[model samples]
Target chain A: MLNRVLHRRTSALVCSALTAALTGCGGGVDVIGYDVTIQQTSQCTVTGAAARNCEDPAVLGQTSLAARWFLETADDGVSVTVTTHEGRTIPGLLFDNNTNVINTEGCAGEGGRCVFVRRRYQTSDVNTGCSTFGELIFVGHFPPDAPQRLVGRFSDVAGNTEECGTPTINEVVFSVNGAKVEQPAQSLEGARP
Target chain B: MNRPLPMSPVLVGLAIGFAGCAGDGIDFFEVVRSRVDECAIRSNGEFCVEPEQFDPPTVEVWAVETRAEVALLYVDEEVWVLDPLPGDADPATVERTATKTSVVIDGLTGCRTDAVREVGFLSVVTRSAFGTTGTLDGSLSVRSVLTGPESCGSTPVGERTVDVVSGTVSGP
Candidate 1:
């Protein structure tokens, strides 16, 4: 009988501990980071819009690649900057729902690979439920070995340029390397015609 | 004959005490707010007050995944900058401020949200030291799942920018 009672007491304590951990009250949430992952890869061909030197057949298809993006922010009484894994500065907007809005540019490298980079400062007024984010997308070719760096400043919603209010929350960095991207199958079927 | 059952006030008191103790916890809103700030600082290194000076945040921190790919949409998030004609301040500047905001991305495809559509808007409000406040609006839309010339070759891979608006802040 005594053993059973002790076992019950231990079980209760364990359950309580687990509850606190899951609720993020017992330092659970702090131990983990907050952000979502976004991956993107694209394919382009020399057709329809502008016909350049065709390296690969103008096969209408998508160049599929797997990418990953994580985001975190700090308040500087003004705007927030997002950073990526490769130490590249991320510029984009943030929507009211706390979503990360983004825009990207790339310059082509050897073998017709282009890479471009940019960033935006997204901010929202929590107390008043007002929110804002930056957004953009760049689709084009860049010469191999084009400068692979992005440096710029943050602007207010009204297009007024400003600097980082807090030094710690300023600046961002990222990196991009050549990777093999697969073409979508549907495009292959469509291009056959 | 029936036997009387025993009642324990001590047990009832313990239960009440435990319930009270469990109520102590950090606020969810506060924690999420802090986390948002942390994410901004981590990605941007430094936060800016002005949208014109804003640059793209970093993508290095994320681990690439292809499964969550969203279809290309007609409209996408864009950034724009709009500065009011010096001293164009007015009480209605709040709603009109979004007009002044700029687009970070040049081309985006989407229709405005209406009663038929429930597209969301992310906005931010700022109050200057001189009691002037403004609101910045950023619009986001999902990618469409149709094959087209601009569909990134059938499978939409990346997010695009559509439009941005800026105006003076409003609200009580």
Candidate 2:
């Protein structure tokens, strides 16, 4: 009876080990069925000559916005996309194992592993072909193994020039936090009864 | 001529005055002429070619002792400052020497090119008596590699060469 009990205990330990290995140990939690939650926290700031205030609704539309995130993993890197309910989408942001040394800007210090892209908006009429727009910088950090959650910041900086008129040099920053919402639909479709 | 036309003092004075005024008008017009028109840019890659982009670029040349500094202000708030040229470097003798300069291109994407290899010629063609006003006429082949934010994708990085074939600069 004692030997049978020992065997049962060993089997239980082995199952537990396998579960831990599959689900990941420590902070690595399975996010297959969890919905992503993104809240515009108060840790945001803005600076520059024409920088808009963080509290300004025109900056980010609404203080609280509903959004969904998706992730695609490949051999090269992981591509992350965050889409807001209002249809604003920040897409095609890729992060790989090699730390990007260029354009660290706000993504420095602990948030070193990052990928960012700057998009310009509003072409200046007075400056003719010159563009006088706010630079929208989207920076995010997603570790290779933990593609479930993303932590990063967004910055909007206005280009300043006399010929481009007095532009509002807005440098508002926003924090983004999200997790995987659900497993791929194909996976469920392929499941056998 | 009919026994040498006799000139009245008043008529002669008025004629002299009109001649002086005409000369002054010519000088004023010369000074007011647009200095930007004398500059032209040719690029193998992208940027700095469109007329609407840098149509009337600001050109300045400053004479400092034995050297001269030239600055060209282009679109997107970009500036190309060429410096340390021999003061006596005229159009004829400028081609024999080369000057190293740096350029900062701040467009939709910010880029910087350092250690720019400037070949060809750049000469200060004319200068006013006070040395405050002048013009430049010459050409320069600028070659360098721009390094910028990686997040800018592949748009703002790589090798670029801009040839300022013929340009005139106004100095302070």
TM-score of each: 0.18, 0.30
Residue-pair clashes per candidate: 125, 1
Q: What DockQ does each candidate score versus the true complex, computed on alpha carbons? A: 0.02, 0.01
- Per-residue CA lDDT of model 2 for A1-193, tens digit only, reads 9965555555555444454344333122111221333333333333335344555344333333223333322234444443332223344555443445444543444432455555566765653544566666566665455765666666556664455445335455567665654442112222211
Residue range with the least summed lDDT across 10 consecutive positions in model 2 chain A: A25-34
For B1-172, candidate 2 gives per-residue lDDT tens digits of: 1232223433444443343332111000012112222222223444443444443434334221221112221212221222323565444345333333333343434444433443333344444586433333444444445556754455334443443434334323
Per-residue lDDT of model 1, residues B31-83, tens digit only: 00000111111111433234444444321110100111111111112221112
Top candidate by TM-score: 2
Where does candidate 1 stray beyond 4 Å?
Answer: A18-24, A30-133, A136-193, B1-172
